[model samples]
Target: MRSDTAALTTITLPEIRLRVRDAHKLRGYFGELFREHSPLLHNHYEDGTFRQQYPLVQYKVLDGTPTLVGLGEGAALLVELFLRIRELDIDGRHYPVQAKHIEHRTEAIGPVAGLRRYRFETLWMPLNQDNHRQYQTQSAAEQQAQLTRILTNNMLALLKAVGAYASDMPLLLVHLLPGEPVVTQFKNQSMLGFMGEFVANIALPDGVGLGKSVARGFGAVRRVD
Candidate 1:
């Protein structure tokens, strides 16, 4: 009998769920992709670093009656290609998969606020493949471009699954840096020490001042650290 006691490594990706005026259309589009990418059973190592053994593809739906939509083998093939394209060596580099979730606010708030609210929860998981020192050596532009690429790729893939075009939405990303208190909360919950450097943001579509207003409300959190 095989022991089911494999070490568990959790990587939380908090995504900013963009609003689609047509939810039914969006669901029909991504339903296929979700079914394809999520593995019925995943196997990986728990060494707390990025090894070749870490599974690169994963999927789950939360807080809504959203269905699991995957493109099966087609998505698997894409994942394989994505891995090849990335070819990110873990031996001395660190990257994080930060998820951002955005939702519409039914109730209204302060003066001149839009009818939507964007809530961002950033979960940071360090890649042990590379030393932190080596990873920070890149120019700021290089770092932001790389981070944007990783994030946009995932977003595009998910959007493709749902049959929606991100080009239509025109995402305005506001990157954020965490403060000491927020870091403390994450450390307590995740048992992983916070680096105090994670790309978290509250994104808003056009015609919305909610994200901006929220950013002003939380003054301590810097745009970038």
Candidate 2:
């Protein structure tokens, strides 16, 4: 891989620190998604920059469940996969995974206690328009089955980029901005956006926030073993 691309491919755990008027509110917010995704030790601030080694997409969960609106470029593909999974028209046979999936893996630790530990991966699944249309026509059972297959394949690809044991499972969070968000790209940094002067950034050092060297080392070992 090119140095830059290799750099980009590296996965890092996110660091977040949350401050709130009521600690229970904070726990309630994360507890909503605890069964499916994990929250690691991250810095908290009413307003400040998230510390990262690379530029990645960051979401501020003003609410518990992350909707699709929370994703930036760093998280777009994963969120897109989630959207595809949810677009299923059938009932009962939704994607085998649900919002509660991460909650099952949640744990309470020290100061950073009461959150889950999670891993993340990304995949690029190129599909033709014909398959897309066919996907739309399938029965709920068939559609969910297809989604399971597709999700598994995509997650495998994500593992190739990151690792197999990064997170317990995959979850999608969305943005709930009242209106359109303004996005700005930079020459040496991550993407930034604004929704009515409230800023949201998609920078790197993502995936539960591990450093580049450590991520690469883990990936290398996984590849060889």
Candidate 3:
């Protein structure tokens, strides 16, 4: 594997924060806004500039308020494109929202921590492996192996997304909180396993996400330690 051990020039990412009113149950809110304003978002990108290297525009609802996190330096442009709205229509529900910006906290974020250890917790949704049903019929040891594979796949994707392809990343230890299965909005008309209360201890960067539907805030991970 190749590695870029050179120091990365720090880039300050600005989050497009928003406060929503009268929306207690916002399952697919983020997906809706981007879908509704696809053109407005698309206009900002030059041809072939918007590759999915960790979602240049990451969307999430924090503290019951929706936010669009600009992963790139040019991400703040999204705020200008949508901030003029008094309200946004997400998943057929009109939510009154206030939009603004704030710098993402990055002081303690890194792929390798001081102790080579990190603890991650889900913000809104859970860490879904998409292998929930397989676990039901497996032995305890087999289940653990399956779970680790799922988490490892997730972490590997994150590392690749950020161009971190150094060797030995696969040896990293990962533990996941048992996710309960429930119906989610992704399939719309079908019920599937939706992970809840996901937590992990792995050597990875802070603020990176895992599992399925990360673009719509399904598996949000943050540093807890």
Tens-digit lDDT track of model 1 for 78-174: 3333322211112233323243222222221111212222322222232122433443677766655544444344334333433333354445243
Model 2 misses residue 179 by how many Å? 27
lDDT of 3 by residue, 40-138 (tens): 232234353434544444555555555544433324445445445356565465655544444443232224423343333333332334455566678
Candidate 2: stretches off by over 4 Å: 1-130, 165-225
Candidate 3 segments exceeding 4 Å error: 1-54, 73-86, 91-99, 104-110, 113-133, 168-170, 179-185, 189-207
Best by TM-score: 3
RMSD of each: 18.2, 20.3, 6.7
Across residues 96-184, which tens digit of lDDT does each residue of candidate 2 receive? 32321111111111111122222222111212345546766888666545544543443333333432223433332212111232233
Superior candidate under lDDT, 2 versus 3: 3
Candidate 2, position 79, lDDT: 36
| Candidate 1 least-lDDT 10 residues | 211-220
Give every collision pair in model 3.
none
Task: Write down the lDDT that model 1 would get.
Answer: 0.27
lDDT of 2 at 103: 11
The clash count of every prediction, one per candidate, is 31, 45, 0
The reply for model 1, stretches above 4 Å from the true place, is: 1-122, 125-134, 166-225
